[model samples]
Target: MNAAGFNPSERHPDLEMLDGYWSDGNQARLPINGVPECFIDLDPSHGTLTLSVPADGPEPDLARFRSIELATYTDGGDVWWEIRIQVDDSLHEAYSLLTRIADLVQLENQAVAVATYQALEAYRLLLASRGGMSDEQQTGLYGELLVLEHLLRTLSPELIVPAWMGPAKEEHDVALPDVHYEVKSTKGEHRRHMISGTQQLEPLRGVPLWLVSIQLTPTTPDAGRSLIDLVAVVRGLSGHRLPRVNELLVSAGWRDRDADLYDAHLTLRSKPRAYLIDLSFPALTDARIAQVVPSASLVRDVSYRVDVTQLDFAGPPSPMDAFVEIPEEKTE
Candidate 1:
């Protein structure tokens, strides 16, 4: 009974094509601590072992080929104990499973990044359409909030700012612990006193409110129509009456009638003057106006509190840009 034990060194003539290491010595019969005793059929042609053991071995819960290593022997002797079985196929299968898991993680991360960018772009366009520059300070504040919202959305779905706070008077009802914001913006070089009462108190409480201020030049070509000008334009042109040409020019600070021709180029009948404002105080940080607003030049002071930070600006060609393009259809 060739009791040299299982000899993995001796290559099987037919099993050599099975693509794995084999035992060289005689097959050995041994019992495992938790396994049932049974007969196994060794096929050298296919390099596989068919276990004749009953299914009554440990309920198959932990019966994985990779979990157990095998050895061979003969005649119940210790000689064949030195030979070990190679489980190359089992190892290869485990490695492939791990690789697939890593690939799935990478794909998930990429999808999330792309989705974040798209959400930000869509929000940017939405704000530009609803936001108005008539009040440069308010418009600037709106732009900032939109950007902050985009960033928050990428991190968590629960962190969100509502689209509307009802009328300007109902800001308090919508305030949350960490999620409320109230923005106050102004134009000009001087700081103005902003008084807060019951009307604007709730939005300013313990929430993370941010105050933003913008300085603008009235004559700067890039300046869009201000909120005041928009209101005036709407009032003047709503009826058949053409808007007052003189008021429009004066508000724009144009002294020369020769320069008045510039008004014709503007799509809107009137444009409001631009004023640079100094944002002196963030209301939550200080109780007194003197502590916040600085005694400086050309600064118009306005104060409002908000939770979100500035993200993007509204401008032409940006979603705020009014011009739309129509594609021409091909004719047969």
Candidate 2:
């Protein structure tokens, strides 16, 4: 039987009671009269709890040392418990030392998670500013989507794995093979054709897919260049017809008017000819290629390096700088 309720001076009933022969700082055995129901002592400020029992116990029972449970209570009355298990006298001191070390490890892991979250938040803000979505009333909506993508990638790396690894069915059938993403951005209501397509060939099988949609607002007057948008478009092109690639790129102004249409040999160019570009093509098994085109050659990988600093912004009023400020009227 045990007692409940708080006792100001009395030790908590949950504490383990040890009875034995006491030495300088040890317990030898239980008293002949059996273990005591309760024991009292000042709470320890640190490390092991040192208890002393008289060495003359009626050949005290050391086993009683293993049954003790220590408890603590806050001034506000919340109770906490600690278990005390006895081992050979030689091992007790080492075990006590290890208990404190384990606690330190848990504290370190908590600190790591907190620091990572802060860094990730800062990166999110940087991406929003780079995408020109930092203004609130201007409907820079894509910033939020970019933030979400960064968050998901940082928190859950497995969500972006290829479909061959047993990814969910809905996500597996999309266009690109190595990247999976969804894009949401803002556009203008007056713009009839806001979304642009891609020039990349869709993977014949097992390609990753990404879906992107854009919303427009009047404040977004210069939200034209879509680098992130292009990423989404390419990822969604898996399994699309080869001819469709040329049509999409031609409509998007990616190729010159005289450029050959979607020829496997035609070099794809990114604007300004200054940025580095790389393309990944999906591998096709012999049977798969035979089904698509009996004599079609595999698409070779592509790479490009462009230097944009050489290109002039063109005109005293730069298009890229227009969003930096609104028109100001001169006072008389």
As a whole number from 0 to 100, the lDDT of residue 250 in candidate 2 is: 33
TM-score of 2: 0.17
Considering every candidate listed, which one attains the maximal lDDT?
1
> Every model's Cα RMSD, please?
29.4, 24.6
Candidate 2 backbone clash number: 24
139-220 in candidate 2: lDDT tens per residue?
A: 2223222323333333322332222211121322222234432232334332111112222222234433322223433323
User: What is the total number of backbone clashes in candidate 1?
Assistant: 38
Candidate 1: tens digits of C-alpha lDDT, residues 11-106: 121234222323443343322222223333333343344322222212222112222223434544422211112222332222222222222223
Worst 10 residues of 2 by lDDT: 266-275
